[model samples]
Target: MDQTTLNYIVVGLSFALYFGIAIWARAGSTGEFYAAGRGVHPVLNGMATGADWMSAASFISMAGLIAFTGYDNSTFLMGWTGGYVLLAMLLAPYLRKFGKYTVPEFIGDRFYSTAARVVAVICLIVISVTYVIGQMTGVGVTFARFLEVDVTTGLLIGSAVVFVYAVLGGMKGITYTQVAQYCVLITAYTIPAIFISIALTGNAIPPLGLFGDHTESGLPLLTKLDQVVTDLGFASYTGHHSNTFNMFLFTMSLMIGTAGLPHVIIRFFTVPKVADARWSAGWALVFIALLYLTAPAVGAMARLNIMDTIQTGEVGSPEGNLLYAERPQWIKNWEETGLLSFEDKNGDGRIQFYNDKNADFASKAEEFGWAGNELTVNRDILVLANPEIAQLPGWVIALVAAGGLAAALSTAAGLLLAISSAISHDLVKSVFNPEISEKGELMTARIAMTGAILLATYLGLNPPGFAAQTVALAFGLAAASIFPALMMGIFSKRINSKGAIAGMLVGLVLTVGYVFTYLGMFFIPGTNILPNTPDNWLFGISPASFGTVGAVFNFLAAYVVSMQTEEPPQEIQDLVESVRVPRGAGGATGH
Candidate 1:
């Protein structure tokens, strides 16, 4: 069969499989809907967490970002992965032991203030909504590429799939669905990397292949990559060009944001015990590391491959570079989306893909009868087009389509669940209708979920950035508003409800403001006060790194406010002490 028919066949099968799993695992009660009945196995929950945690940002956009920016973007890999250590050691078991259905519930109960819970719900909603935009966008991109549909249609179809599984199955349905998704996504991710690795370095293991000698160049893979890219006037593939302090802050923001995200934390609550939560975090990391380890290799190899393709002959020669007529099929496909463009700057009919910013390179380009760089590639296309670029089998390309969708859909479902639970369980039932029936609450949860899907889909259609960049902003907000509050609630018994609420407000307000000032005026078009550039950053901290600063402000504000206020009630203090140990951990029984 041709690629399009094969793509439909493979992608159709995956969707059918997911819908079937959702139907088989439909949730029956609020408990099942919220936390999977608290009976999930540790290993299974771990796999589910891996799927939940690795969104489109991780699977689709990350390696591509690294491919274009080189080592400067390693912050993404380290920040996202390192936060799991914090989750495993500091947050997951304690939250699991607290036996709550939603993150705000823990905050409200721990602080003994309904106001604290309400603030948490707002923060959760904000973080989750922003995060889901990326997933929605990813789904749209995947559909537009493989299914040849428009982004709006792709988003609607994706939202329908998520609504079917997430609304019907709740956490129960999502957990098992995510487990199957993890398998599909990871397989899709690794198979392409393995093929590319062997093709580049004669090594099957991607990480080893990243460092291994290139079969053709007889130099280390990275060494060859650095040489090729720099030869094309780009920075060395291994060099770090971003500001040092900003990189550190950016990395810290991602770490804190990862540890603080409500969706990942809720996965631990589904497991049977506190011990299970801990082990599940480890297992989740093991699964996550599989992709993390291979990503650098994929990025590096893809960059090298792309460069080699464009620069087929010696630079500065009349015959240098691939002619426009000789452009590959992958380029043609992406060009239709406006993601890849060619300008033919010199009207030479040949494409010059190079760094025009390098003065030395510009002078040489003049000598070579070249005007400037002519090809523009979107960073996201690196991973998406990798299989096609390498001329891998039609099935492999189709699998990438499925994998990208699976990653986006799984995480979108998880975020929507978090948002719906916050509204229905935490806001509607817990505070507004304390006497609401379990059945009424479950129905409300499903409704809230449907509403959230509509809102997120709308936002996804007009996302502020690429899949990963949009998600990173959400992380910054999470790090600022949620993570610090949870840490103080557990580690500092002296922090009062007043202090916690104050911290979240300050963090949320300031972080959102900072992000908006650069992103746009509340993300409106052409409304930003300042351009989103490094020169306009605060103390050299980019908006992506501003989360760390917000977190620090949260810590200080909470501490300072607590010093001037009354302490938490003695009973609340004891509740804090109880969760610190794993002895009394049991299945979560109540909302």
Candidate 2:
């Protein structure tokens, strides 16, 4: 069969499996819809959570980020993964035991304030909407490339598939589908890494192979990579060159942000018990580490591979040249989708694939008769294109398409689930329409999912930033706004409604304003303001890594406001005490 046909069969079958699961495991009620009726097996929930957590961003963008940026991008790896540890330890079980439908529910009920709930709702919507768009963008990109459709058509199709399963199965359907997605995505991700690892480093294990000896250089893979990239203008693969302060802060931000996200926190709610929540988090990490460990390895090796492909031959040999006409099929395929593009910026006949501005190395390459650098590969293509680059079989390539779709869809569904529940259960049912019937509530939730998906689709068509950037925005907002309130509600009893709301608004405004100044989301063009480089940063904090500062502001604001105000009522303090202890937490009732 042709490659495109095979891709279609594999992708179509995978979606069919997801839709089938949605049908078979359809939720019977609002309880099942929102929390899978709190009955998911811990192991399965762990897998689902893994799939949910590792979205299209992790599957598609992370390795590529690590690949091109060298060691500095480790913030993404550290921040994304470290967040889960925070979730497992600081938040997950307690939130799960609190027995709420959404994060806002926990905040409002624990703090005993409708206003607090409204503030939580606004934060949830902001974070969840931004996150959902990223997922939708991923889904569209996967389909546009593999399903051979336009981005718009692909997005509609992808949105429709998620709607089917999400609306039908709700949490129950999504949880199981996510387990399947985890299987598909992990297999798809690792196959290429394993193949390329053996091909480049002669080691079977990709992770160890990263540090293992390279057959060509007889040195560690990272050692060879650092040498090659530096021979060009790139930073060392295993060395650090960015601001340590910002790196540390960025990592902290992603950790708190991850713990704060509504979709991820709600997953813990489905596990059977508090102790199970703890272990389930460990299992989720294990599953997540499968990709996390492999990702950097993939990034380093893929960077090395591209360099080797262009630089492998004798300096003047035609074989040494990266020719536009002689490019690989994967290059052509991705180019067709506009994900992998090169301008031949110098317009030389040959594709110059090197860091030309490496003042020291530029002179040597010029003496060697090379032209200016030309290639500009999109980082998002790294994970998705890895299999094809490694010469993995057709099945493996197909599996990647399936996996990318799985990752994107599962995450989109999860975010939509979070958005819908916050609206239907927390906002509408809990605060606004307290007299609504259970069936009416469920329908409202489904409708809200539909609305959220549509908005996400529109925004996804032209994503405000890269997948990771969008996710970071979601995390940043969650960190600045929701996380502080949730954590204080659990850990402190003095914070009143006024304090929480005011603190959240301040955090939200500061973070959003800073982000907009750099992102150009609010007014003037982002680049016109500053370069976002070390030389231009405020207090050496990169904009990409400034959420930690935003979060600290939140903490300070909440505390200051709380101390100046009346103490929370005795009943609210008692409620806070009840949530902190372990005995009746798993069995607590109502949002």
Candidate 3:
């Protein structure tokens, strides 16, 4: 059978399972819809959180980024994983003890200000909406590549699937569906890595295989990879080439942003108690690390594999390179998607995949009669094509298609829930219609989900950035606007409502302004005031890294404003103290 047919079968079966689970576990009440009735077990919640947290960026694009950028991109792995430790220790327990349905609800109540809640709802909507664009785009691209449909058709199909589950079951349906998604994605990710590892290094374990000896070269896997890439005029595989200051700040931004994201923070509210929230954070990290640890290894191995395939033998010899006519089926397939291209700049009929701008390597290429590099491989193709590159079985390739969809769908559902809850619970019911009935709220939440899905689908067709880059922006906004407010609410008793509100607005405006100056105004075409490059950046910090500066501004602004404003009410002070202690904490009741 053809590989595409197998992919359709595997992906179809997985979607069937997800849709079935959503139907079986359909939500019945506002409480269940919003917080799963606050009855989820810690481990199961952790698994669900894992699936929710690892979006298309983590599953589909991260390793590819790492593959192309080398050690400089290690920020993604370290920042994303390290933030969980901070989340577990600083944020999760207290938030669970307070027992709120949404992140904005906690912010509003803690500050005792309706205006503060409204600001938070706006921030939550912006961040979640930005994050969902990447997921919806991933769904479109994955279906387009595997299911052989146009991107618009794939997006409609993916959105329909998410709507059936998320709108029907709410958080209750999403949680169980996410558990199954976690299983599918992890299995799909690991099996290919294991096969590739064994193929390259005679080791089944991917992490260990990354450091193990390469079976063909009698050298360590990384050592062989470094040598191969350097020979092709690229930087060494393990070397750091970015400005140190920018790298550090970018890593810190992603870490802070990871902890602050409303979708992730809301996961803690689903668990039964404060203790479960704490334990659940740790378990979520454990599950996340399973893929995280394997990603770098896959990146290193896949890079080596691609270089080896093209070079064939010596880099500067006539008999060494793979001719264009001899390109593999995987190369041909990806070329059809317009993501992989070869120009043959030297017109030698044989592909030359290298960094042509290396002045030091120019003489060597001239001797080999090569003009410039010819092959252009999109980073997102590495993982999806890895199994084929390694000549793995057809089933493994099918599993990869299903896995990417699972990761994207699970995260989209979680973000939509956060958006819908913010609209219904925090904005509409709290402020506009306090007398709204439970049934009415439920109907509104589903309606909100449907609207959010439509918006996300339209935006997905024209994403502001690639999968991972767009996600990083979402994290930056979350860090600047939401995280500082939450930490101050729990840790400081003097942060007044006015101070909190001012800080969030300042952070949100500054971070977004800096981002739009380079990424285009509201991400529309022909609207950017400046080019997005390191030389033009302030102190060489990318817009994505500006979140760190924005967050610092939030902290200082809030503190300065609090000093000039009236202190919070004594009763609000006592509520802060009550949430800090874990004793006497019961199941979260209504707001």
TM-score of 3: 0.98
lDDT of residue 154 for candidate 3? 88
Models 1 onward score TM values of 0.98, 0.95, 0.98
Residue 386's lDDT within candidate 3 is 90
Candidate 2 local lDDT, 1-591, one digit each (tens): 988899999988988899899999999899899989888888898999999999988998888888988888888888888889988988887787777778888888887788888888888998898788778878877888888899899999988998899998999999999999999999888888899999988998999898899997798888888888776667677888777877888888888888899999999888767777887899999999999999989999888888876665655455566777887788889889987677665455566677777877777777766776777687777778787776778888888899989999899999999999999998899888999999999999999999988888888888865677678778888888888888898889898888888888888888877776666663235543666457767787756566777888888988898899899999888877876776544344222
Using TM-score as the yardstick, the better of models 2 and 3 is 3
- Comparing 1 and 2 by lDDT, which wins? 1
Query: Candidate 1, which ten residues in sequence have the lowest lDDT sum?
Result: 582-591
RMSD of each: 1.8, 2.4, 1.8
Q: List lDDT for all candidates, in order.
A: 0.91, 0.84, 0.91
Q: Per the 3 Å backbone cut-off, how many clashing residue pairs does candidate 2 have?
A: 1
Q: Residue 496 in candidate 2 has what lDDT?
A: 85
**What's the candidate order when arranged by decreasing TM-score?**
1, 3, 2
